[model samples]
Target: MNHESQKTTIANTVQLGSDLSVNRLGYGAMRLTGQPGNFGRYADWTAGKQLLRRAIELGINFIDTAESYGPGYNEELIASALYPYPDDLVIATKGGVLKTAPDNIRTDGSPNSLRRSCEASLKRLKVDRIGLYQLHRPDPNVPFVESIGMLAELQREGKIRHIGLSNVTIAQIEAARQIVDISSVQNRLNLAERNGEDILDYCTQHNIAFIPYSPLGAHPLKRGAPLANAEGILTEIAARQDVKPSQIALSWMLHRAPNIILIPGTTTISHLEENIAAASITLTADDIKLLNEAQVF
Candidate 1:
């Protein structure tokens, strides 16, 4: 097993208000589900429990999940594994997308649905207050403020500690903040995709943590791209550092912004450990330059 035994420290940690202090190196629990055709197929109940426990032992203090993950199975798994959860860990989950049969997905931003989903998530995660509750996506049928207004109400009632948004444009981010505090933004970003660079830059400037989902590019990456496509410079860096391309890619994101948090997912302990180990590896200035250069095109 090629383990990332490097021992480097992050430059700084982001303060998400008074409720939590995130170390910036976090885990994404999306892979903890039995999603069809997912690389990290949600493992058996026993395997899921072990993986969640191992994540904590590796010093990962932050976790990201969604109510749509497993449609509820993922939260129940977290409860089964980490119930009576640690006080220091920050668990972030999102709502707003309604998943039905035959790969059908829809949005519901009605105040009643938002309230009900938040309450149901509480029951599944087995927690009283969500560390970071995010509105998964904007609902075209409903006004953005209307959806966020409901979230704000939840925070006021002691049901949530912080608020976040996902898969939204900068304009949407600004709009949502008008109604509630926006602590973080989760967006699709990876070596092969740089569409969210501007949002990332905006977050860095404002001290908001930018959580990059799919830090590993989605399948069918450009030919010879690293980390996902396995063809990009990430592969080259991995070879040089004796680490996995995925680790190199993750390290790049961590280095890209002081306030960035990575939530790479994995089902097996080996992959999980490898993902966690990226935190300890520090890239050189030359490494950064090389990766950025390849970002062109």
Candidate 2:
């Protein structure tokens, strides 16, 4: 149970809103929907389902997904895999992005679009109320407040328990609080990207859960390789620690801030186990400095 392992995991526990307490190193379900760019149905549903089951066994209580991911297949995948639903598990699904192809993600944050998406997610996920529902992104075509208003209305109606935002700015968060309390802010952040650092800082100061989507890069890592190339600090520290470069990057994120929650998604059981173990890899202040300066953004 989550209450039992506060001190065991390096990333530790975070209480979202008032009730949902989940492990910091959570699992992202976006990649579960087969790949080419997270827009296609998984090639193997059985493997996808089992992956979700094993993730929970490894202490990953927060599972993140979106309606745009597989255009609805990922939510259905979670329901199929773990739908009796553990008492300690928290399922966070997103909306606002639509999959037009096997590789494209287009933002659609209209309130009607978001409401319809939430209704469908409730059915597909087989849940009366979603633990956390986030807007996938701010839509250029619609007023951002109008979209968040839809999520706030859903919370009042008991369709969503809490609200979160993704790919947003600090100003946006300030504006959104005028409408509803923001529980979490998710953005693409990693050694290769520091664009979300300001957002992460704001979340930390406000006690909002800062969930970083890609703790590791999206592509294959050249682990334990030379650090001479400037952005190779991950490999350099990884070499010193005798772990894979991906682990070092993930571990750094844990040490980077207290409010951060990592959601690193992988298909293979081996990599999943590896990712969960990264929470235990302690990075020193010096190590954090070295990795901190390796940004490509």
Best by lDDT: 2
**Candidate 1 C-alpha lDDT tens digits along 50-160:** 989998888888889877777777778888899888878888988997766425668987788889989999999989999999899889999998999999999999999
Model 1 worst lDDT run, 10 consecutive residues: 217-226
Candidate 2 runs further than 4 Å off: 1-11, 219-231, 295-297
Model 2, TM vs. native = 0.90
Q: Write the per-residue lDDT of candidate 2 for residues 1-297, one digit (tens) a residue.
A: 342343223548887998788898899887777667676688899999888999999989999999988889999999999989999888999999888887566888998889999999999999999999999889989988899899999999999998999989998899899999999999888777777798999999998999987667664222221212224667777787788777887887888888888898778888889888888887766677767666533
Q: Over 4 Å off in model 1, which ranges?
A: 1-9, 37-43, 219-229, 295-297
